[model samples]
Target chain A: MASETDYVTLISKDGFSYVVQRSSARISPVLKRMLDPTGAFLEAKDNTCILQDMPGIVLEKVCEYFYYNEKNKDARDVPEMDIPTELCLELLMASDYLDI
Target chain B: MSGRRGGNRIRGPQSALTDFLAANNISAAQIRDDYERRRQQAEQDAADAGEGPSNQTPEQNDDEALAAAAQAEEAEKKTKKRKRTEKDAIDKIKNAKATKKGKGKKKGKKDEEDDEDGDDDADYDDDFGMYKKARPAPGQFEHCDICNKRFTVTPYSKEGPDGGLLCTPCGKELSKDVKKEQKAATKSAGTGRKRRKVESDRLDGIAVGGAKSLSQLCIQKVAQHHDDIEELGDLPPSVLERLSEIFSKKRVMKSKTLPLFLRPDLDSVIVHDAAYLEEEDYRQIFAIVPNVRKLVLSNTCQLKDGAIDYMLERCHDLRHIQLYAANLVSEGMWHRVFREAGGKLECLKLSWLDAAFEDLVVQDMVKYCPKLERLKLKLCRRLGEDAVTSISDLPELKHLSLQISQNVSTPVLVNLVEKRGSGLQTLSLEKFIDADDSVVGAIHDNCIQLSKLRLSENDTVTDAGYTALFTDWDNPPLKFADFNSTRDIDNNNSGGPEDAIGLASSGFRALMEHSGASLRHLHIASCRHIELSAFMDVFNGAQNYPALEYINMSFCNRADTSVVAGIFKSCPALKQLVAFGCFDVQDVVVPRNVALIGVPRAQDAIEQFGIGIGVDEAISRMVEVTT
Candidate 1:
C-alpha cells in the first residue's frame, strides 16, 4: 500500500521541477504525468505532474501496467475486484492525485 | 426632428427653436429673455423703418395689442365658418331624418319645437342671455377636442338652465362663469322648451332621432350618447348625491371599457383586454366608439373555439392584435385574423400555442401581416424547419426567436443564417438541440453581426465546434508538414493522428491549432470526458486564446490538475474557472510566473511550497514520496 513518505518529481513542459509526496499526490491528478511514456525508464522529464495516494506497492504496480500498456498499446478495461473499501479509497485518492 | 402637424408634413417653427435651445444648453429663463428681446427688437425696427413693417404703422402704438385683437378676430371668423359648416351638415341630416320619420305622422310636434327653437334663437340674438339659454345645454353640445368638430346631443340639454344653450363652438369657447349663468337661465326657462322637446322625442323615438343627428356627429357623439352622459354633465345638485351612492354600489362593474380621457399625443385608444372580452361586452364597447385605431389584447386569452369569430366581428378598426399565450390559435384563426385585419398589424407575438398549428399559422401570419416587422415565436414546439425556413423569407422581419427543440439541424439553420443574417440581428436558440459544428460554422461564416447566441443546454456541441467557429477559416494552408507526416504514417496506425491531428480529428482541429488563441469563452459543460490531445491542440501549441477569463469545464469526468497546470502556464490572465462537479479536481499546481497564489480559505486542500529543487533532491524524490 502507498504511504505518505513516497514522493515523485514533476517537470513542466518548460522543464521546471516540483517535488511532491505520494500522500499529497493521492489527492491530485497531476501526479499521473509520471505515467507518461518517454523511453525505457521512469525518469522524470520536462512535463507537468504531481504525486499519488496509492501505496508505494500500488504505485509500482500501476507504473508497471502503464509501461506495458504503452509498449503493447493495450485498450483492455481494468477488471473489477473485491477490493477493500480503504484500498478503493486509496485508488480514488491516487486517481484524484494524478488527475486521470 | 421635424414631424407632421395638421395633416401637413411641414417643419415647425419649434424645430428652429429646438436647435437654438440645444445649441448652448440655454436655460428656460434665458430663452424667455431672448424671445422678449427679439419681439422688442422687431418693434424697434418697425419704428425705425417708419413706413413701418408693411402692415403695421406707428399709429398702432400698441402693436402687440393690435396684433392680438386682429388674431382674435380672425380666429373668431374661422370658428364661425367651421360652426356654419358643422351646423349646416347637422341641420341637413336632422331635417332629412325628421322628414323621413315624420313623413305622415307630422302632427307637427318636432316642427313646432323647431319653430319655437328658431324663435328662441332670435331671442338669443336679442337677450344674448336668452340666446345662450336657447343654445344647446352644456351636455347638449358635443365636441371632440381631437377632430375639433361638434356633435348634437341626442336628448339635448333640455333639463338644465342652459338647455339648447351654447353652440358646440361657444360651449367649448365660453368662460366657465358665462357658461354657468347661461346654464342657470336655461334651467329657469326650461319648462316650455322641455315639454315640446320631450313631446317630439316621444313621437320620433330615440333611435330615429339618434340616426338623423348622429350622421352630423363624429365618434365624439358617443361620449354624449353614453348612458351616464346626462347623469354626469348636467346632473341636478340633488342627483349628485344619488350618483355617488350608485357609483359606490356598482364600482367594480362600472370600470370604463376604454378610458374617455386620452393623452394628447396618443391618437387612438388601445383596448388592452380585447381578447378576454365577452361577446356582448365587445359589441357594446365597440358600438360606443367607432374611431379606435389600435387594439392590443392582454394576457393569454384562450380563443376557445368561437371567440375568434366574435372578436373579428366586433373589432372592425383593430389594426394590431397581440395574442401572446392564446390557446386554440389554429390555421383557421390565423387566416381569419389575417383576412380581417392583416393590413394594419405591425407587430405579432404568438409564441404560446399548440405546436401542431404553428407552421400553418406562421405561413398565414407572414402572408397576412404585410406590414409586420417583429415576429416572436419562442418555444413554439410545433414550429420546425418549415417555419424557420419560411420566416427567413420575410423582408421586414428584424427579430425572431425559433427556440424549439427539433432537428433544426445544420442545413436549415445554415440556410436561415445565410438568408436573414443581415436583417435578423437578434435570433435566440435557448433550447435548441441540433446546434453542431456545422451550424456554428455557418453562423460564424455568414452571420457577421450576430452578437448574442444562446445554446444553453446543448450538450452535443464540442470544443472543436467553438474552435472552428472562432478561428478564421481563411488562414489554414492546404499543404502542410503535418499533412505530409500524417500521410506518410503506417496505414495500420488506427490511433495515429489523422491528417487533422490538431483538434476533434477534423478540420476544426487544424483551425484551433492555428488560431485557438482567439477564443474568448470556451464552455465544455457535460462534454463527457476531456480529451488530453484536443486540449493540447488548442492551448498547447497556441498562445493567443490567452488564459480564458471564463472556462465552464463542469461535469467533465476527465478534468485533472495537469490540465490546470497547462492552463496556469499558458493562460496568465485567467480570472474565473468554473469546473463544478469535475470529479477529477485536484490541487492546482500554481505556476512560478505568478509569484503569489490567492487561494481561498475554503480550498484548504491546496498547499504552497518554495521554489528550487536541488539535484540531490531529484533522485530521492520518488522514494521520499513513496514512504
Candidate 2:
C-alpha cells in the first residue's frame, strides 16, 4: 500500500544503492533521526542517506536484515535469518554504530 | 639456507634483513677473517720495510717515517670499517628475534650464536640496545634481606631495601606488618567519628522528647558512662529540666536524680516515664513538691497504697493526674484518692490496669469528680459493663478513649452514646470487636458533634449496620476516619457460605460520598471483601474527594492499577497513597505533587518518566494498558 514517496534511498561507500520503506528504515535509530521530518539534515530533505564507513557487501546484508525483521516483527513463530559466518563481526560492528 | 646459517638456529622463516644479509654473502666469520688477513699483511709489509731501514740515510729515514704514518692511517680506516660491519651483525641478531623467544631461551640462543661468530664478548655491547638488558642468571641463590636466609631467585622475587632480594615468607610478613599499621590508624580514626555520632545521637534523642523507649535510652546512657553521676544540685533549673528528661527517658530516675526534679517553688512536676521510680521516690516527690497541681506518671507499679495516701494528703491542690500501668494501686486506694482529692480534678486518665480497677472505682470517680472534663480508660480489663455505663454520668466530659475493653456490651455503648455523645468530640473505640448494628445506629442517631472516630479492628460490625449509619445521616463530615482491618470473620466450623461482616461495598461508597469533601485522613486497609467493581465505580472521575490528603488501602488486592489510577484522577488534593500488598497494581503513574508508597511496580514507572509527567497524561497512559 506504500507509495514511492514513502521509500528512501541508501547508498554505500562503493556507490551501491538500495531502496527501503520508511517504516523499515525507522527500525534503526540513526536512520530514524536522520530522516525525521523535524530535522534539518540533507537526508531528511531529500529522503536519501550515504554511509561512508560501510562497504557495499555489508550494506546489502544490512538492508536485507531490515526487511527480514519487518516481515517477522508480528509473527508468533519467527524463522531465523541466516548470515554468513565471515560477515558476522563486521555486521555486529555496523549494527552497533547504527544503533539498531 | 638452513645449513648456511648453521644447524637449526633460526626457527621460523628468515626476516627481510636476514635474507638481504645472506644474499650479500656477508657472514660474521668471513668479515672477521678478512680483517685478520689485512692486519697480518700490513705487519709483513712493515717488517720488510724495516729490513732496509738500517741502509738508508737521514733524508731516506724522514721519508720512511712519513710513509709509515700514512700506512698507519690507512690501517686504522680499515679496522673502523670492520668494526662497523660487526656492530651491524650484532644489532640484527638482537632486534630481529627478540619477540620470538622467551628471555631464558633467547639468552641460551645468544650464547650459542656468540660461539658460532667467534665473538666471545660481543653480546655485552648488544645489551645496550632497548630490547635487551643484562640480568642475573635464573636459579641463582641469594640471601633474603630481612631474614638473611639464602633462597633460589626468580624474576618474581621481591626487591628489598638497598636493592636486596627478600624471600617469599619474609616479604609476606613485611606486607602484613604494613597492613596492620594501616588498619590500626584507620580504626582510631573511625572511633573518633563514631564517638561524635554517639554524642549527636544522644542529643537527638533528647530533642525528640523520647522517640525511643525508656529502656533503650537507659541502656545507651549506661553504656556511655559506666559509673553513676552523684552530684547534680548546682545545675540551673532549665538544665535540671533537661537532665530530668534525659534521666526519665533513660529510666534511671532513682534516688540519685530525685532531688534534681524536686523543688518547693515548682508547682507542677511531670515524670513522663516513672517505671523505675520506687515507693520512696514517690514519697520524696510528695515531700519536696507539696503544692504541685498537675502530676502525670506513667508505669506506676511502684506506687502502693502508702504512696497514694501520702500524695492525696500532701498535694491537696492536684487538679490533673494521669497514670498508666498502675496495676499495683488497689481499689481501696483508688476510692480514697477519688473521694478525697477528686473535687477539683479536671482530667483523670488511667490505663493498663489488669484487675485492681473495677465498676466500684468507676462509680466513685463519676460520683466524686463532678467537674471532670476529660476521662480516658484504656486496656483496663476488669472494668465491665457497669463501669462503662457509669461514665455517661459525667456532665462535662469531652474526650473519651476506651480501647480493647471487650466486656462492655452493645446496649451499654448505645446508652452512653445516647447520653453524652453530643458533647464528645474525639471518640476512639479501637478493637471494640463486639460492637454491632445497634451501636452504629445509636451513634448515627445522637453523635452529631464528632470530629474524629477510630473504629478499627472491629469484625462484628457488618455492612448493613454501616449502611444504615451513613444513609441520610445529619452529622458533620468527619476530619479523620479509620476503618482499618474491619473485615468479616471467616468461621471455618460452619461450612455454609460465610456471612460477610464489617463495611461492604455500598456502605463504603455511602461513607466516602458523605464525608469525601472534608475528610483529611482515611484508612481502610485490609478490608478485603469490598468488591473491586464497587471501588472503581465509587472512586471514578464522577466522584470527587477534594480535601482528601492521606489514604492507606494496603492489602486490598482486587484494586488493580486501573483502580489506583482512577483514584488518582478523582482525588484532586490527594498527597499520599499507600497500596502495600496490592500485588496486581503495577506500572501506575503518580503525579508530581503526590507521593505513592508500597506500590512495587509504580517505582519503575516513576523512574522511567520521572516526577514531571502531568496527571491527565499519566491516567491516560495507565488506562490504555488496562483496556
Candidate 3:
C-alpha cells in the first residue's frame, strides 16, 4: 500500500499539512509512541514544538519511510536511509534531544 | 524572624551553633552558671523521691508534696532564668548590630583602598575564575559526571544504571560494544569481511625460516600488543566530529613492519617496508584494509604461508605489483599467488629475487598473470625452460628479460619466438650458455617486431648463424631457405629469383644470410664465431631498416674492423654502437654519428632512449672514445 494511503494526516509546526496513511507515520518508533497517547484523531501538535531541529523535508521523508515499513515490520528490518550529510547531523542531534 | 530561627537551627550543627555565639566575644558566663544550678536542683529532687527517711520530721505525705512543689518551683525558676538574666537580649542585639555596622564600614574603606591600588584585587578574582574554567594542569581534571571522580576527561557519557561518573575505561567499553554491534549489523545485512595476498614465488630456494611459524609469532605479537593498537580512542570533540563526517574515507596504517597481503583495495597500495613480514602480520594487515589496486611489496621472504589468501579475498582493484626479493618463501608460492592474483595483473617486476629458480614456480607464474606485458626476472637463477614455455601462451606479453639466469636454455627462447612471434618486441637473453641454432631460428622466425634482441655470451652462435639472423626478411624480400640463392639475390639486380634459389628452408639458415635487419639493438657480444658470408651481407646493404637504433657487437673475434665499417656504411640510422673487446673493429672505422659506449654503458643509453630523455651516463664514455 502507498504510504499516503496508510496514514490519515501529518501536521507540521510550520503549518504544512500532510494527509498521510497510518502505516507511514508508524515507520518511526518515536512517531508510533507519539500516536500512543493521542490516537488517530489526535493532533501531532508536538512536531511544531518538540522537534526543534527536524527540517520539514526530512520529517516528511522519515514519515514516508516509517509508513511503508510499518506493515511489514516482522519480515523486514528498518530500511537504512542514505540521508545527506547535513541531515544526518540534524537527525543525530534531534534524536539525542528526544532521548531516542 | 520566627522562621529565620528555625532555618538557623536546621542549617547549623548543634555544637557549632552554641560555639559560634560564645566565641563572638559576648559574655554568657551567667547563663552557663544558671544552667549548672538547675542541673544540681534536679539531682536533689530525684534523691528525696528515692528515700522518704531524709524528711521524716514533716508529715510524710504533706512533706513529700511540699518537697515536690518546691522542686517544681525551682524548675520553673530555672526555666524562667533567661528573663531574670542581667545579659539582656536587647542589649546583645544592639551590640551585634553595631559590630556588623563597623564591619560594613571596614569593607567600604577596604573597597576605596582597593580602587586606589588600581583595582588589582577585583582583576585577580576574575582571573582566578577564568583560570579555574580553563584547564590549569593535567592532574587538575574537571570531575567526571558519572563517577563523580576527578578525571582528566569531562562528563560526556550517559549515566549507567548505577549512576556514577563515566570514566575512560567505562567509555571505552561502551564504544567497543557500539563497534561490535555495528559490525554485527553489517554482517547480518549480508556484507562479509575480505582478505589480501602477495604475488610472489615460493622462497624455498633461499632456505629462510619456516613461513607458517614466523607468521603465527607475528600474530601472537599483535594479540599481545592489542591494547597498544589504539586506532580508536578518546578523541578530542572537534577531531571526532570531523572523523564522523567522512567515515568511509578513514584509512588504517597498521605499522611499517607488518605487510598486509589481504586488503579490499590492495592493488593501488605501494608498500615500501613489507619485505621481511611474517605470515601473521600479513593476515592482520589484510584483515583491516581489504581493497586496493596498485601494490608494491619489495620483500617477500618475510611473509608467512596462508597470508596470500588474505590478499586474494580482499583486494578486487589490484593490478600491478613490483616485488623485490621474493625468493625466501616456501614451495607452491606461485600456485597460491596465481590462484589469488592471476587474472587482473598486467605488469609485474620480479627482477631482484635471485633465489627463486624453481621450474614449477615459473610455470605457475605463466599460468597466472596471462595478461602480463612486462616480465623481468633478471638474475633469478631458478628460472629455467619451464618459465619461458609457460609465457608462450601470453599473447599480450611485450617485453621478456631473462638476463644472467643460467637456468634459461636456448630451447625456451625458441619456444617464446614460435609462440609470441612478431608480438615479442624486446628480448634480452644475455649471458646464456646453451644457445644453439634452434634458439637462433626462433629469433629469426618469430621476432618480427624484435627491435632489441640481446643474445650475449652464447658461444654456440657461429658466423653462419649471425648472417642468417641479421638479414631482413620483410624488407629484402629474401627467404634464406636457399642460402646461396639469397646471398646472390643481394648481388644481382638482374636474375630470375625463382630459378636462382638453392639451399633448404631453415629458420637458422635465414639468420646466416642477415635476414633480421629490422633489429634495432643487437647484443651479440662474446659469441663463438661469425661466417664470412654474414660479413658480406652487412657490406652489400646500403638502405637499412629505419628502426634499427642501437647495436652491440662487442668481443666478436671472427669479424674484423670491416664488419664495423660495413655496419656504419649500411645502417645510416644507427645512433649508438658498442664494439668493446671485439679486437676486430679498428678505431678508424668508428662512426661519428653513432655514440660509442662500453658494455655497462649500454643499459644507460637504452634507458635514455626508452624514455626519450637526455640523462645519460654513457655520454661521457662516447666523449672519451671520441677524444
**Which candidate number has the best DockQ?**
3
Q: Give the TM-score of candidate 1.
A: 0.32
Best to worst by lDDT, what's the order?
2, 3, 1
Query: Between candidates 1 and 2, which one is better according to TM-score?
Result: 2
Candidate 2 C-alpha lDDT tens digits along B82-141: 455544543444343335234534344444443444332333233333122212345655
Q: How many residue pairs clash in each candidate?
A: 43, 0, 76
Best by TM-score: 2
**Which 10 consecutive positions of candidate 3 chain B have the poorest summed lDDT?**
B195-204
TM-score of 2: 0.50
lDDT of 3 by residue, B43-90 (tens): 876777876434332223222232222232233343445345312332
Candidates 1 onward: DockQ, in order: 0.00, 0.01, 0.02
Q: What is the TM-score of each candidate against the true structure?
A: 0.32, 0.50, 0.35
**Which candidate would rank higher by DockQ, 1 or 2?**
2
Q: Which ten residues in a row have the lowest lDDT in candidate 1 chain B?
A: B479-488
- What CAPRI class is candidate 1? incorrect
Report the Cα lDDT for candidate 1. 0.45
- What's the DockQ of model 2? 0.01
Model 3 lDDT tens row, A65-84: 44434443332222233344
